[model samples]
Target: MAPTCPSEVQERKILRRSRFGCRNCKLRKLKCDEGKPRCKRCSSFRVLCNFMPNVPDLQPVTDDSSSTFVVQGRAQLQPPLTSAVWTSDASTFYQLDAKCQDFVTRYLGRSLITPDDPNMIKVNRKLLILAFTHPFLMHASLAVALAYDRHLNSSLGCRRTVEECYHRSQSTTLFNRRLGEPIETRDKDTIWGTAAALVILAFSAPDARTPEESWPLKSSDPSDFEWLRMSRGKMSLWSIANPLRQGSLFRAMESTFAEIHSPLPEKGIDGIMRPLATLCHLKDSSTPGNNPYFNAAHAVSQIQDLLDSQVKVGQTELFMRSLHGPFESLLRGKDPVALLLLYLWYRKAGRSIWWIELRARVECPSICSYLRLYHKGYAAVHAFLPGGSLAM
Candidate 1:
């Protein structure tokens, strides 16, 4: 047996510098000099460079402690980790399980606006695509999907409370982490998406509260209205991202708000509420001319006008912004009329999940009880009010 010659030794394969090398160089297994317009080798050969675009950077899937597990019948299947690659520095599309992917896809495909406004559909689609590149948005989208899924399944008598809560917790953890960052430094897209996510979270998740903390025994403890505190936080976030008013997400939100704040038709339920509205106005007039109750009623009327308008495109946000003043005044004054107005406002705002969530969290029934205790004669009339009628 003779010793092998150095020239006969096999060369080990090495990773290429550019995955998108020129065709000639790639075919010949030659290193590409990825030059703009054309590589040196391609130039020398007088051939088309034809370099492919670089693929996006994504961390390859790896087994780790955080890997997802699928539970089925008392046994867990450790499916290969299939989730979008989440990196601290940037977001990259990876993969998701079939069920999760289908949910996202369906949400994107659904019509988000009325038939008359086709452009909004395009805008929501863009936002959904943007969600794939932003972690906060991605988490927020997933949270919405989880919440919607849970609600739909519950209606069908399939309870998934534990699983839904677990996923929601994970999604919110990511959402809050991004939300806590300084608003000024974040990009416009991120800020816009954050606002959208916050709205979704407001409706989907329970109001933020101190874990294990019970309801305050004293009403004046300041922590009693944890849900109100959460609402204010959402308002603050929206304020910070106010510049994104031009965006489609904001427009969609405005549309939803408009639908919620639309005036009750004058024929049916309006008749029941008319007397209460009249009494509220009278009470406001009895006070000093600069009554906060009057201000709130005016604000509510403006909201109604915007909702009833034929062209309500940009009015939703404007009305919402204008409303802050009356809302704060009403809360500060602790006026029964203001409280009743708020209850009615929430009742009217039927389209938004946020208002629905707020209605439940704020305990409208408790507010009604407080109103009755504070004001006697009107309370009797309120008691006999028909279902779905506004009570003063």
Candidate 2:
């Protein structure tokens, strides 16, 4: 075979110069304008600009694990930005695959998970960047992203998809190891971020479709309220991570922390409905630390405040916090008052938190059935619940 220069002297199509742009520009496969200070595309998109002025020559990064140097085909990341597809084999820097890009970009652009706060998104964007550096965090993030995607697209069921399960398992293994080993200050945020992600994964999925099969209604098991336990368990990492400390990426979330750690009122009956107060046996002396029913009753009342104020975010965590200590024991012991308060909380909280509805829809009705069957005397509280006829 003889190599020829050309059969008929053909003209070369001159391609546009790109390649040496900022991370965001390179990520979208756009021909970088190579603008100083900030790139036009990133500015127009309102995304973070990681551009450097008078950049040095591109050298292979010491850590390919978190590098955005890999070329993921635009086909995998949708909305059709380019007519040309990247040559798949040209990208040798592996690990950050097309799916990861698809998920993160879609998540940031769409505001899929935490939609309310721009500040929250900024913190999460930083967390996501950190996720690329930590394998466990990456797994945890993907697990949550997949769970939320399933929640949005798939039909109602508590079961997680296989991808969700695999990520969750992998993250758990590595997360524990990171905690056990002495961690650097930089690693602290990664631990906290992964912990938060894993908690969301746990809360997002439940294993039952019926209240009879759900916790408290179902036969008592050691794993009852395991999701609640896992979420609360993350508080142990608070001092370790010190997320609220200055210079921490999560310091932007101090408002969120305040919302979470709002002190319990001195009197549990402060805002409780008379019926619920009586049901919980709330007295002038009742406090969360003293009376067992006080916390559960207080939690139920707070839901009304949320409704009255038209507040949605952070209420799910508030309800679960009530389930700790005496309230949890009472719930596991199947105390009538605890079950009644829980049913009321579910009825109110279901409307706001998307994932809570999955458990609440089944559990609310089941609580009604359980009450009717076991605690017939409490049927009078039915007036408080919207669908009280079933309990009656």
Candidate 3:
């Protein structure tokens, strides 16, 4: 029966639900519209739209006790011209690193020096300039540049046009060449490695999402492994190596060491042993920049793994060769700086016993002497040491 069409009140309630955007968006305080072509808000926002299901048979009854009542309201929505969007391009990205940029700029300016090293002077000056304009952006940009420069010419070395080396390093071929491979036609591994490396170096310090304070230096969580940094992003070394499969970057870094004239290990597989040993050597040296505990541990563990493995002598020598470099640095017997580095690696790897062994091995005058030298610089350059332990 025509049943008076449930009066004007019931019809208004039906129309309201029939018109426009999905119920989810509307419930969430987002704009929406009930429409045929597209909801007004969805169209304006350039987002997809969906409608609530209609149940034709389910009719409203004239029950005075029912909470389901209808109200007639009229409001028109117009599609807007602009909508929000996201893209991979850094320049177009939002102001995420504004704070970090400011801090980096000021830090560089304070440390700016008239070094005899022209490359250092140049990079320092450029860094200063970027600090004032955009520190966070510069950090990433400079890293890319530095990586690229390394890719172009292995002999070019770091501390020069670091930004350029970093940039070019993103190119898989360029990145692979830094490890002594000729730029190749196509290797996705190289490309991924390049990208991963840039991301690690560029974003390692001073970022909001993964703030250093919250992250464990020696986490066993696989999630924390940053392949580019050759350190775990979250997981512990045990868990990281098995599932994360970070052997590639380690291989690349090891190859890079050998390519740069560092001796290869004598035993184990040529691939992993060389890189692991090289990392150990680098960690032991007075290399510039911060050497985080996790990083040092990762390198150390990788070296220990090779030594413990049953491999050919020459292959094993490649790994053992790394010990000589660091050992020599330790044997000078002037200070405990070598011991300190070893200690950090041992501690981070959760090998306190190993730390004790390393500490005991170092000659006193050298250990004590280096400790004093490190103390003076520790306050200033301690940034290289992770976990911010005031004591060296």
Candidate 4:
């Protein structure tokens, strides 16, 4: 070829030697200004400010992407390396479903109830107990909805429906009388369950003005009040179980998650175990048919099984706060199911802790309610039965 122009010759020389583009521009695939010290693209991007020398005077920067590099063979950079950044934009509900299948499965029977079905009623009653007494589930939107939905299928319909029942029950002032007429009138188990359910409903009252107060009745066993002493110590049953034993514990734990279906920290439930233990005491000691303390202890021990193989932190907290009032009553020695009723009342009132505790303290007073009821029941037994004194 004829003599090439100097500028054209230089351009050909640089372009011919390069593979894709300049090193800095190739990583980002951007246009290079080809400035001295650093290319304009690299400088604008705030990348490393370095120039590739035409001749090898100084060693090229070491490829220490994996290893730490020492400056002057003495010290290393404080942080190691810069990796690629990641980003995503996805649907929350989709992510929630993907992550929280286990939580959804726990309330399957309760949440999927059909009206006019006996099984549905039983499931609703059980779920009501769980929702009314579960502190963690009560606090979360998803958990509460899941547990409450189960109740809806059994007898109630939805959040709005439950609120309507709460209001209607308020007008009756028999907020605890779901089986008010006692259809069969003679099944002890049914009677006991109804009594328990009514007791729980007392706690479920939405406001002092509506139902007026906590349940007027009290538990008839010392075991119910005894759980408060256990609360003073560390490591409640909720703390001891890795995953927990009862299925109900996981009822409302789906929507309130941090990452997609990620497991929560193991010790997450440890803080609330004492309170839960107290709830078990109230539930167990409602009647005198068995050693309520032992029964309560056994029920609480099963809480470990209630946890999924893996737990989520946010969901656990959600379950705990939702049922805090019932658990707290367990600590203070209220009737288990009755306390659950109080929980429902709080639930109806949007589950306000201040309102629940305030009404409970005003209505139920303290642990003395259960103690007095037990003493009265004990006296009644001795006064009426021939060998009551020797029955123990």
Residue lDDT tens for model 1, 91-203: 22223445556767776444333324565576566667666556556545655666665544443223223334333444455556656666553355555655555554454
Better of 1 and 2 by TM-score: 2
Q: Please identify model 1 stretches exceeding 4 Å from their true place.
A: 1-95, 111-117, 150-186, 204-278, 281-289, 302-334, 351-362, 369-376, 379-392
Q: How many residue pairs clash in each candidate?
A: 1, 0, 67, 44
Q: Candidate 4: where are CA atoms >4 Å away?
A: 1-200, 203-298, 305-330, 333-392
Off by over 4 Å in 2: 1-98, 108-113, 312-315, 389-392
**Candidate 2 per-residue C-alpha lDDT over 1-392 given as tens digits, one digit per residue, 9 for 90 to 100:** 01112233234344474767786566344667878776786666544455753221121223322333232224242322334211122211124446656776676333344566688878878887766557677767877788777777866444665446555765786678678878779888888888887777766777665455666455666765767777877878999999987789989777767867877677747787777677777878788777888866776677666652354545546667777787887888887778777877776776666556666667676666666566656666655555555331
- Candidate 1's displacement at residue 136, Å, is 1.1
Q: Could you estimate the TM-score for every candidate?
A: 0.52, 0.70, 0.23, 0.20
Q: Write the per-residue lDDT of candidate 4 for residues 189-302, one digit (tens) a residue.
A: 222322323322333332222111223332233433221232222123223321122443322332422322333222222322444434334332243233233322332232
Root-mean-square deviation (CA) per prediction:
22.8, 19.6, 23.9, 30.7
**Candidate 3 weakest lDDT stretch, 10 residues:** 206-215
Q: What is the lDDT of residue 157 in candidate 1?
A: 22
Q: What is the lDDT of residue 119 in candidate 1?
A: 56
- Over 231-325, each residue of candidate 3 has an lDDT whose tens digit, in order, gives 22211222322212343323323432243233333333333233333433433342323332223333344434433222221232232223333
